[model samples]
Target: MATTKSSSYHHGDLRHAVLTAALEVIATEGPGALSLRDLARRAGVSHAAPAHHFKDRTGLLTAIAAEGFDLLADALADAPDLRERGVRYVRFGVEHPAHFQVMFLPDLLRGDDAALLAARARAGGELRAGVTGMPEGGRGDDARLAGIAAWSLAHGFATLLLSENLREPVGERDPEEIFRALAELLF
Candidate 1:
C-alpha cells in the first residue's frame, strides 16, 4: 500500500507550481474550467494555497494575460520586418492558445491590474514598431490604424486556423507559409 503526500510543493515555490498547473488545466480543459481549488488540487497543495498568490480567479487570469503580453512582445522583438512580425504574432497565438485566448477576453481578467496594463502597453508598442513608415514622432492615428489592421489580419487568421475552419482550404499547407504569402500581398 502507498500513501500520497498531502502537499508536494517545496519551499518558496508554491506559486510557480500553481501557475504551471493552471496553464496545464487551461490547455487541457479551457480557461472557463479554471478555479483555484482545481489548480490547488492539480498542484498537490492545500485548497487555500493559491490565495496566497492570487486573490481570486480574476487575479490569476490577469497574471496569465500579463505574462502572455510579455511573451508576445518577446516574440515580435527580433523580427526583421513587418511581415515577419505578423507571422510571429500568428505563430504565438497558434502555439500558446491558452494564453492567447485568455489575453483577449477582457471580461475574464482584471482590467485594473497594473502589471497587465504595462504588459499590454509593451505588446502594443512592439506591434506598432513593426509597422513601416509611421510618423517620425509619437504614434498618430494613421499609425494606430495600421497597427490595428495588422493585428486584425494576424489574429483573424490564427483564430480560423485554431478553430479548424481553414483545414480543408489550407490542406497540405503550413499556416506560417500561408501567413507569409498573405502578408506579402497585404503589406
Candidate 2:
C-alpha cells in the first residue's frame, strides 16, 4: 500500500522522492522534458513542493549531475587496477547511460554548482589516480596523458556502444569485449 506524504516536506521524504522521479524522467525523456511541475506530479506532491527541495530547474539538474559524478567516482575507486578501472568506467557509462549523458552535457547543469564541482573533482581524482598507478616509473606527464587517453576511449566507446553504432557481423565477439580489447591495444 502507498502511504501519502504530508504536505510539509520537512515531515517526510518528498525531497528524495522528487529527485528520484526527476532522474527517471530525464533518463527516459532526456533533460529537455524536465520541469519542476512534472517532477512534483510524478512524486505526488504539490507543484510548489519541489521548490522546497530544488530552488529551480537548474538546481534539480545540478543535483542529478552531481549524483552521476559521485556514482562514477565510487565505481572508479572500487577497481584495484588501472586497466580494471578503465573497464569499470566504461561499464558505468554503459549501465548508467542517462546519468552519463547528463553529467557530460554541461548546458543541462549549473557549471558553478558547488556539489557538482566537488563531485567532478572527486571523479577526476579517481581517474588521475588510476593514471598514476601505471607501473614502470609512472611518474610524469605520461600518467596524466594516460588518464586522459583512457577516459576519452572509455567514454567514446560507451557512447558508441549505447547507441549500438558498433553493431557488426555475426562473426564479431561481444561489443564490450571487442572495445576493451581495442582499449588494451591502443592505451
For each candidate in turn, the TM-score is: 0.89, 0.86
lDDT of 2: 0.78
C-alpha RMSD of each candidate structure in angstroms: 3.9, 3.2
Highest lDDT model number? 1
Q: Across residues 54-156, which tens digit of lDDT does each residue of candidate 2 receive? A: 7999888888889999999999996776777878887888778778888998987899989999999999999888777677464345666777788888888
| Candidate 1 residue lDDT tens string, 110-154 | 999999999999998888888754444433457767778888999
Clashes of 1: 0
* lDDT minimum window of 10 residues, candidate 1: 1-10
Best by TM-score: 1
* lDDT scores of the candidates, listed in order: 0.83, 0.78
Residue 45, candidate 2: Cα error in Å is 0.5
Against the true structure, candidate 1 reaches a TM-score of 0.89
CA displacement after TM-score superposition, residue 153 of candidate 1 (Å): 0.2
lDDT of 1: 0.83
